[model samples]
Target: MSANTDSQLAKRTDMKLFSGEKLLVIVSLIGFALAAGIAVYISIYGAIILPEGNAESAFSFNAAMGMFILSIAAILPVSGLSPGKRASVRWFFIVAALYSYAVETIQHLRGINPRFSQVGTVVDQIAGGLFGVIALLIVIATALFAIPFFRKRQPGERPLLVLGIRYAFVSTMIAHAAGIWMIVLQSRYTGEAGNLIVLHGLGFHALQALPVLGWLLERSRTDEKRTRQLIHTGGIAWTLAIILIGLQTALARSVFELAMLPFLAGALLLVWLVTVVIAAVGLLKIRKGSMVQTNTVSGEENRDLV
Candidate 1:
């Protein structure tokens, strides 16, 4: 087939597949239900069945649950877009979740971080090693694929949707990078991480946090321009907050430390200033574009009248 004919044929196939949109919705819904169900089961089991001292096992379990949630959340909306794009992003998430499930299940059942354990046999150690590598790859893939959502697009696209997607990406990328770094450092030398675990958990949650906040903002009957500004401002502030927490953790300082309180207050002020600057710049650019379009429309109307 000629190139044009091939393109037309491909487009026809996509249209036929996504025409009803019902199947995609059903698939996403089923995935969501499965994730939520597993999450609930795990939570109850962790609280009731598991012994209290197994910190590593608990972390693994929670990470598995979180990955499942993140995968479904990230895939559902993206599925509504172009099918090829949806397939690429969706598989990345789904595969990540599946891999996490395997690794966490192993950790809980066997009780070993294969990299550190001399007790485990070769197979177990190998699986543990594979877990870390797979996790790193998944985080990298998620962060990279999420970039397209941040790019400027037509006006009708909801600002909240864009901000939520980008925020999820940024937060996950940072959390995973920090976590992988911590793993490396631990392998090299056992170090006390004052609040590294707490920091990482909070940072990772921005995936759900900022996105839900954006969704709440969307429900307000605010002006679209104002909403966009709010999103940019809120997202930047959220990023800064996560960074500060990570930094404080790296310094071996707890957020609740008496000395850190003053710095935390100062950071809040800085966040406010930075958010204002970013929001102002976004508003100005939006205003300029609106004026230019308005002028063009007015000119065309005048010509018609004449």
Candidate 2:
């Protein structure tokens, strides 16, 4: 087949996958709406109606935001899958998103913590237990969706993006492990100084951070070898940072405490940040160069027409 024909076929397949992503897109929008509503409500009432000492607004808001972020992150991975696998994962996302939204919104409105509430009734506890199950389902779905990225690069797949996604999935799994730890302990705190939530939150964001870096690098027109090296540098740094943070948390020490472990983690994070900045600069330069070249071509064409 002609290269043009192959390209056209790939485009059609991509379009079909994109169509399947609509449900997830809608779910993400709902999450955003819910988060906005909760924020507005909190601003208006200032916790007057919320249960005392529980930070209901914050919990509800964070839940909504998490749904939104995860849905958005899932889109690319879902699109990378075969049609049958894509459909299954897509449905799993819908179920998990809706379940989370309902449980978080309802429980918070009823003056209970959905994940951990000593004062909640039996039903509430059941719902919280179900929430944990849903979380495990999400982790499984994510792992399935991530499989395609690890397979041999298909025709037209961007190398850097795939590498970034692999790293992101690994880091996200670590984040999920941290979440499971919280579920087992029934607390977000590890000890006097440690807060597992910090590790959880930071680890989850590797999904957005590393993949985005790879996407940007793909467009940056940097050398292929250099781009791959940078992605590896960033991914390794990010993973090491998460590992250090996890170890610190497990040791009952604060992630930000003045200690060697925390300091090493901070330095690794800084290294990742530096790589991101470098990629951003490369992207900007390439875009600027492209714009100038386009303008030049336009001017030459105009002269030819005249």
Candidate 3:
């Protein structure tokens, strides 16, 4: 029985899409399209579709969030079998995406805004803290499961992919926290020069690239030299940008505040654009039949050793 089970599992592990990763890429494209469409649709025609002051007023938020959830429904399928694989992280992404929608729903129900409320203030400061702990636990679980696969990764490879993504996620969470702080004590933190605050620009977006870096590092996707170069350059750029923005955010003069808003927002948006482009490049490389060039573990190496 054990032998038969192992054989079956081996077949699944060996499986790859006929189109390689294009299958997943197509799914991602569709998801993004649907999410954008849903968001725009609701934003533009919502008042016409759902009358104001009716119970339907909040429906747009829920509906838009639902659409976002649908776009990533492939999360479970993406994770495949095992807790440690990219698929597992992919699944967590699905959870995060869905939870984002759920949070939005809760926000709408709270009944107070032309914009989103901070989770820390309205929900519980403890809620984000608790959720982070939970996410860390899940990451640990997935890492343990993936250890076998990860062990095969190259020793010298930089995890730019994973680093990028993790940073992005963390930055966003911190963004929410900062926003909450700003809202709760708008007077003190809003215009105050003395208060310490991270710049709200490229820093958050730059952070997104960390997870991508980590995943790349974990997978041993490319040359050590090239990876190191990427990390050094990208990290420096990200750091410098973050510091500049943080400084601006923390110490911009009162009159210049509104003027700086667009630049700040644009900087963050640019970071996201750069991150997305990197992911696209990664996908392109995979499609172009690039290999990770790791000597530590190859199909033959792992097959014989493991």
Candidate 4:
């Protein structure tokens, strides 16, 4: 087939798979349920039953929410893969999600932290190691899936969405680095006040935040040039925020400290937030305009019928 024909064919295949994307949805729902269960458990016990200095509630809540958001975000890119690749990747996510839930819930219930727990039994340590391995696998898989986004946009592909995905993947890699740093140090703390968990959490959220910005811009009926500019602004600001946070953590300084680095990072985040608000406002205006037009047409039709 010609190159154009090939693109069209791939686009059709992607749409078909996108419509059938259910496994990831199921996995995301399961993650939500696990998170809810954890919340209920915490409420009933009034504590997470972990050692001092360890925030078990944060750990468990973050894990569950991470799985949920990751699975939901995976649906789009995974469906863009070939049929065989899609099935394999989908199953990999399902298994990983399940393993993560089991390890996190079981370890917490046993009064053993699932990650970086030095005082746990041999089994707990082994489970922690396996969790790290699973994390590595997920990173590799996400990197691989990101490849398609960097390629030439296929027919019917939204350029802004692809661009946002590329940015999101890069930010996610940075976040993963924070996670690895924690693994190496065997703690989430760097200095007296620097917390790697803050960096890690912010970094991972790029996966959702950037893409949603792009999606909102795309649907707002903005011109392509303006849309691209807005996306670039938001993407760069978000990335800079992550980098600044990482740098502060690496310097063993708290990101919230009264320091220049923290100030710049906070400012970048605000810039991104402003862009998102702009896109959201544009979308609302478009929707409102469409509704008024539809109402006007309905009134005209009613007059004709009368």
* Pairs in steric clash, model 4: none
Residue-level lDDT tens digits of model 3 in 209-301: 544444444344556576555554444445544544455556534323455643654465466446445645665676456455554348678
Model 1 per-residue lDDT tens digits across residues 1-306? 788777665643443322434433444444445445545655665422332123344454445355435444543453235657766656665565556655554454455553455566788778768777876776777666666676774333445655665776686777776778667765421245355665566566666656654555555545778767766666676777777777766676665566664376347536645644554565567677889999999999999999
**lDDT (tens digit, per residue) of candidate 2 on 243-267:** 9999999998898889999999999
- Return the lDDT, model 2, position 147: 74
Q: What is the overall TM-score of model 3 with all chains considered together?
A: 0.41
TM-score of each: 0.64, 0.88, 0.41, 0.89
- Those runs of model 3 whose alpha carbons end farther than 4 Å from true positions after fitting are 1-38, 41-99, 103-111, 114-180, 183-189, 192-202, 207-223, 252-306
Looking at candidate 3, the ten consecutive residues that score lowest on lDDT are 47-56
The models' CA-based lDDT, in order, is 0.58, 0.77, 0.43, 0.77
lDDT of 1 at 59: 51
Off by over 4 Å in 1: 1-56, 71-76, 79-81, 187-193, 261-306
Runs of candidate 2 with Cα error greater than 4 angstroms are 4-19, 47-79
Error of 3 at 75 (Å): 12
lDDT of 4: 0.77
